[model samples]
Target: MKDAWKRWGAEDERGALNLIGPDEVRRAVSLVKSGEVVSLAQPLSSKTPGPKHRCGLQHFMNRDGGDYAAGGRRPGGFQFSEDSVVMPLHIGTHIDALCHAWYDDELYNGFAGNSIRSTSGASRLGVDKMPPIVTRAVLLDFVQLRGKPLAADYSIGRADLLEAAAAADVQIGRGDAVLIRTGWLESQTGVTDVSFDIEPGIDVEAALWLAERDVALIGADNYAIEVLPFPAGKVFPVHQRLIRDYGVPLLEGLSLEEIASRKRSTFLLMASALPIVGATGSPLAPTAVL
Candidate 1:
């Protein structure tokens, strides 16, 4: 293979002999302490979203600056910064928590209001219910496998996923944190103002396929995992199937070109997102190390 690893075997080989397993993930976690941290967030920028886009993040007041009095002596330097923000949690690079979705008003893991504590507000299952996740992650270079970016309206199916795995020569295991790279994130250049639209994304069946495989989470380089202009006029069937039905989290708006460059099947995939209580989603930055 043109991208085969040296230790894996000769270039003519179809697959690697040494595949990464769960033990590798445990060893990487053991090397880090509680305070030892890693940053995995893409900076929110005004330039990224175009003029037509609406992000209402105008500069208010920084915690470091401003005094108690009205426009009085500022404790810290009074720096005026500006930002644009929107309330859509699905906007930008974010991870959808389990509580972010519901089917028939019921959440994942079968959390019921009847079992809630007495004083809680409406006794709803929130993202806080999700415990810390530590699992094996597999990066699928879907774009590369297709020899181009995924079609704008291309429907990603289980066959495409299997083809990507075959092209990458990697085997996915149960509970794997699977990340699919579509190269769409790379197309969002400094000059381009890429707007959101219903485009290429996976169908509900594909979501069920991953869930049946017992995947812990599924991520993609696109805003929505399923192709846009969803089939049957559905908005986000992938999200509905995964988070609402299976309770699997979603990581979106990833920049995976650099990570996918190294064709290694086994690696320490490290990622962290903000622990915003009750929020539907939060920004994230995940990395894969060989």
Candidate 2:
């Protein structure tokens, strides 16, 4: 297995996020000359497509127009509507907290992971602890380069990353968010045939490569950021190494199609995790401004 340790110190919860200092933010701002902002989040709804095991997004209206029609009185002839949502935070465009995946009963930065706080959520390194992510980002359009979506079982290696970066003429730097486009999300044409178990994503080598460059975040257009069906004799190698060992956040299920279509490979990225206390993950709606 790959090595696991904390460079941000034992008490640190932000992990590689610590790399995003003032200079990183200022450098990101310099990439915004075009003033064009594009959303990189998929809409969240009960109707949103997701794997069966995730249970799907559920939405309910607490009050609506039907209330008054059913003889329910309105105060001062005024009416309003309220709604509620119940769904897994990992279902939509979401970011996994540093404590999300671990092994040997230890989380990122050596936090105890054995005693899970099921009711209250993660006892440490929850999504709330994550700061708003603002920095430079570079998109790797692997789909367009391949002329189609990569295979479900495809393992994206470090060479692929370098090739794509060179093609895009973008030099990935420290504190930058690297969003890889697999073209998998747009290939969602049906429910039963959806390849949920397997996906095309970065391999462990690629993940370590980014970690070497001190990337703050890693994202993908697929549900899982690493190749699914995993490498032979391996399981979630990227997740364990990146999130647990390197303390990098994983942004999955993003909408990179629009930005890729525009051929904008580099931009200023701004994303925030919902301040859900102790939650292991949070739904995200990141934006890229060129």
The candidate that wins on TM-score is 2
Q: Best candidate per lDDT, number? A: 2
User: Which residue segments of model 1 deviate by more than 4 Å?
Assistant: 1-24, 27-41, 50-56, 59-89, 111-123, 190-192
**Cα lDDT over the full model 1:** 0.59
Q: Evaluate residue 151 in candidate 1 and report its C-alpha lDDT on the 0 to 100 scale.
A: 69
Worst 10 residues of 2 by lDDT: 1-10
lDDT over C-alpha atoms for residue 183 of model 2: 86
The per-residue C-alpha lDDT of model 1 at residue 119 equals 50
| lDDT digits (tens) for residues 1-290 of candidate 1 | 11112332232111111222457457545433333333323456544452245453333344333443446454475544343444445555677765565555445545442433335422343444344455566777777777787767778788878887787677776657788777666666663647567446677777777777766678887777777777776667677677655556787776677656655444555666555555556665665545
Residues 1-290, model 2: lDDT tens digits: 32335566657888888989999999999988879889999988877777777778888999999999999888799889999989998887999998789887888877889645777778788988999999998999999889999987788999999999998998888999999999888888565557678888998899999988989999999988998987678878888999988889999999999999878888899999999989889998999998
Q: If scored against the real structure, what TM-score would every candidate get?
A: 0.71, 0.95
